[model samples]
Target: MVTVDHLVKDYGTLRAVDGVSFTINKGDILGFLGPNGAGKSTTMKMITGFLTPTSGTVTVDGLDVSKNPIEVKRQIGYLPESSAAYPEMTVVEFLTYVAEARGIRDPEELNSRLADVIVNCHLDSVKYRAIENLSKGYRQRVGVAQAIIHDPKVLILDEPTDGLDPNQKHEVRKLIQAMSKDKAIVLSTHILEEVEAICNRVIIIDQGKVLVDETPAEFKARIPGASIDEVFRDLTKGSALA
Candidate 1:
């Protein structure tokens, strides 16, 4: 389980995140929704221990993130918003580097893992292509493949389906759903229907605060016939966040 208690982050005079708290249990897929610059990425970063909370604590399965960063990171896999990668390296080279960095030292084991990821992510055709030479959709797939090469217990994905076609999005969603049975997954997305389609629970935040946290059915049930976007606007239109 991932437990966040009273989390906060500040940038000079601006508060990027303020007193946010939530728990994501195993086998849960939590969809984090917020407007642009509303601190969705910041919260995810803090949860994955990429950024420290200014005040509160984040604990993953009982290990405090700040106190045991390495251990916490060992159990989690993160895909950042930028999908950062070694642009100079081919997909094969890049994934190999990632698998090694993840401590898969046995050559045979590494190759076996790579083979599975290539097929799982449908990267067989582009596996030999340079990351910089791949299309945006292919690059996104490469990013995802690297994040899951080690198959950590927790998954943090920021815009996991960004820049994908309809088919690509469906493929990624299925991968997530299949993985959700074992891992605690947190995904931040601007796509409302995507959340409704896959996420069992949803969180809507604005102005660095959580305005809604409930099941997708309950969230929509708040106003009969209203879409997720309508509920989001109603809850988040109160103030400009960020």
Candidate 2:
């Protein structure tokens, strides 16, 4: 449901994303892997219409993100790495604002959506608390909740389970797996185990370019008996060796 063709993002002389291309179909959860500042988020921002690409294109369901940003945005939900939110607003209040901003005006729909995210993100216990008062895990959950509040067909999550206990991480993985049956999901994560567990396909990038794109098995097979970390290191070993 999403296609990125030759996407490039440049800031002056520095190129952050270069010729990145991929397609995500329904039921496909693509594991976007990269090291720090590897342009994963930059590519995602372009896909979500948050940042205009220096060149190339991101299209969602036949709508060009650059040409029809608003419409394309309606088809995608994005959770950036930081999960920034209005610190002073309570969870309910912040979500209310998000719903309104998303143009979800029907009161019934708003309430239902709110309930769905609260449950999905396991935020029922802290739904009434102010965002600033939340712990990092709760804040991450809140970020997730807001992203899915609209239930867009495409989910782009960066570090979706960044701050949480192991149990919480597993719960989030289950949530993602459940959601993947109907949506096209792209999640950038450092946790290889999470990717192996939840993602159907994997795409690894480095130095602003895609280095490997394969299924988990396909990738693992390249380095027989190696863990994902080992194979990953092997694939991107040049920079480290340099």
How far is 100's C-alpha from truth in model 2 (Å)? 1.2
Work out the TM-score per prediction.
0.97, 0.96
The total of clashing pairs for model 2 equals 0
lDDT of 2 at 2: 93
lDDT of 2 by residue, 41-79 (tens): 899999999999999999999999999999998988899
**lDDT by residue for model 1 over 37-65, one digit each (tens)?**
78899999999899988889999989999
C-alpha lDDT values of all predictions: 0.91, 0.91
Superposed model 1: Cα runs more than 4 Å off: 238-242
Poorest 10 consecutive residues by lDDT, candidate 1: 233-242
- Root-mean-square deviation (CA) per prediction: 1.4, 1.7
- Give the C-alpha miss distance for residue 5 in model 2, angstroms: 0.7
Ten contiguous residues with the weakest lDDT in model 2: 233-242
